[model samples]
Target: MAIHPTAVVDPAAAIDASASIGPYAVVSGPAVIGADCILMPAAIVMGHTTLEAGCRVHSHAVVGDMPQDLKYHGEVSYCRIGEGSVVREGATVHRGTLAGTSTIVGKRCLLMTNSHVGHNCELSDDVILVSGSLLGGHVYVGQRAIVSGNAAVHQHVRIGELSLVGIQARITQDVPPFCITDQEGNVVAENRIGMKRAGFSLAERSELRAAFGAIYRDGIGRNAAVQYLRGAMTTDAGRRLLAFYAHDSARGSGMRLYNEANAA
Candidate 1:
């Protein structure tokens, strides 16, 4: 409703009456701009994208552009920015590569300046991508996970809930929940601070720490580790961690646990 005179919003684009489009911003291709969404100066929202209520597309940021994948042949895919999410300056979020699929940024997620979410990447609620971080196509980032500045996640990798990926890290494997990774993508330790901030009790944190030790420090194989965790886990956090392992990873060999012997 507050579209700037210089903004170029397509007639077919469905913009809510409460939305504000800033100067020189472009909303095109029947994109749905939800209630109270704000397109900052020079932002671009294109393709089959949907900006849910209260979303903010910052200056020079682009959402819902065509995918970067070579497999894409202009199929009708989608990009969805969830309610209350913020895409910061110069960030780019591309649409899905496959037909009828979607790239989803969940509620309250923050994509910092110049960060890139590749085609088909799915980011869960409260996720944070620091400045210049890059997520490859089809990567799935769990809720409350933080990818530090300049980290690059390989395609199809899964970053679990409450995990912290270190700055400039190159993540090629699945990172288990409640963990923290080093620059080389090694799972170094549990995300104690993140868990503490998330309101996990002392007992829950202890249980998770024990689980990590069993899997990473004790040299237990995947089967034995799962069994040990299954019988020992008592808290909701512990169960969630077990469930993360239970799911099949896109990386065929499963996640690699931290090994002190391999550390530099």
Candidate 2:
């Protein structure tokens, strides 16, 4: 381990040999940092948090802090960050609420600068919270979803897989898969570009288009539209879209129809 002289790390903390602690970083007791991770200047990793291999905690970021929830009562909780993730400058990722609950950040995810992930929030693999995005307590972000800069999600809301939440949007409900919503909470269109960049095949893209049409323009309720999508498209991607549409929360915002697809 290459720990800077100005850094202060607890003797009891488990830091891997391949990790690097930069100047003025402070790692308190009960923290475990894995291989190849980098803790930048003035960053603090405390409590019972575990940073998996290949992760990077940028300058001044704070991880594994106590929950802000009143019900926490000072109980012990864990924060687990998966491999190869990046927690950017000034970001704060708090631990769980109550005992046995975990605040998890999955592999390959990015929590941008100044973003705040509240207690009990879970971000699945490949999730991206843009600069200043704030996820309220107990919020869950599905895999590959992107919450744009300055967006705020309400507590307990679930953003489905591969969805795109536009800049500065306020989300109070679940977002269905492949949907894109704007700042005013309108479903402006589909996340075609995102899916394409994620290596979705042509047929899968077509299926998503068909599914979007069925869900928004078919003159049927969300459930009935999902049923139609299930019957019309048989790909695994199609199934995922239908499942998200079918499981949408009552107060959730619908996806939009933006003008054209942007190449990512």
Candidate 3:
């Protein structure tokens, strides 16, 4: 381990042989640093945290720190950062507040500058929280989801896989997979760009497009529409979309579709 002279690492903390601690970094007791981890200047990793292998924490970032919840009374919570993730400057990842629970950031994820991940949040693999994005406690973000700059997601909200949240959006609802939303949290369109980037086949894309139209334009109830799509569109991708539609997402209720509706 290459710990800077100015860095203060508690003797009880576990630092891997290949880890590097930069100047002014603070690694307190009960913290575990895995191999190839980098803690940059002024970074703080405390509170029963584990930085998995190959993770990089940049300047002034704080991970596994105390949660901001009022109910917290010094429970034995945990924060686990997955392998190869990078936390950028000024980001804060708070640990769980409930006993035996944990805050999790999955492998290869990117937390951009000034982002805040609240206590007990779960971020899946390859997720991206862009600069100034804030996620409230107990939020779950699925794999490959991207929350754009300055977006704020409310507590207990679920953002599904391959979703793209627009810049400055104020999200108070669950966002289904492969969908795009605007600043007002309206489901404006399909996340076509993100789907393409994830290498979805044209057939999958076509089926999803038809499903979107069937639900929003055809004015059918959500379950019936999902059943129809499950029967009519027989692809794996279609099935995944059906599963998302069928899932009980309470916040999705009362959410308006992007299309203009006429009073009948």
Candidate 4:
């Protein structure tokens, strides 16, 4: 209830008693702001947006705006930010295009300054979108993945768990788990450092490295590699890597060899 007098919250909006709306913030009638959520100066939460408890919308961030898709014609859609997520200054997360659908940002995520998350994107827990990064519509960023500053991800791409995208890289294909793409957007190394930081066991890390080698260095076809890894590698980390390839991504199989040059 610390809403500033300068804030413009619609009478029909559902704002929790403990929520705080700062100066010049706008909350639309259909929007829902949960307990302990904070809307900083000039932030805009409109349309069918819902911010879960403890979420923070920093200054000038805009959520639940209409999607920019040419095919959109104002059918009902939504943008949902999960608990404890923080949308930093000047960032925008667009709503979905199709009726009843929603663009979702998962729990505890961080969207840095000026980042743009296009319509229908799903960002999983602990995902970090660095400053000025742009995610095209329908992109799926997996848990704990980090898209570095100024990088751009193509629509429909899937970035797997614990992956690291280098700064300003242009990502066009699916990036598998525990991998790192170079500035030129080529898969060049295992994200051993990230996995360690995430507390993967030594045995799990060893298995993941073997699985990566089997997929990329073995030179076998994608299907064969997947089958081989599924049976050979039994660690949790190994299973995670296999699961990423089991389903077909927009970029097709062998995501471990994503850029085709595979220098890892």
Local distance difference test, per candidate?
A: 0.91, 0.86, 0.88, 0.88
Write candidate 4's Cα lDDT for 108-224 as tens digits. Answer: 999999999999999999999999999999999999999999999999999999999889998887888889887767676788878888999999988877777766765677688
Top candidate by lDDT: 1
Ranking, lDDT, top scorer first: 1, 4, 3, 2
What would the per-residue lDDT of candidate 1 be over residues 98-183, giving only the tens digit for each residue? 99999999999999999999999999999999999999999999999999999999999999999999899999888888888889
RMSD of each: 2.4, 2.4, 3.2, 2.4
- Cα lDDT of candidate 2 equals 0.86
Can you tell me which runs of candidate 2 are displaced by over 4 Å? 248-264
Model 3 global lDDT (CA atoms, 0 to 1) = 0.88
lDDT of 1 at 240: 92
**lDDT per residue as tens, model 2, 146-231:** 99999999998888889998899998867777778878655666788888888989999888786666565554665577668768
Error of 1 at 14 (Å): 0.5
Q: Candidate 4 overall Cα lDDT vs. reference? A: 0.88
* Residue-level error in angstroms, candidate 1, position 136: 0.5
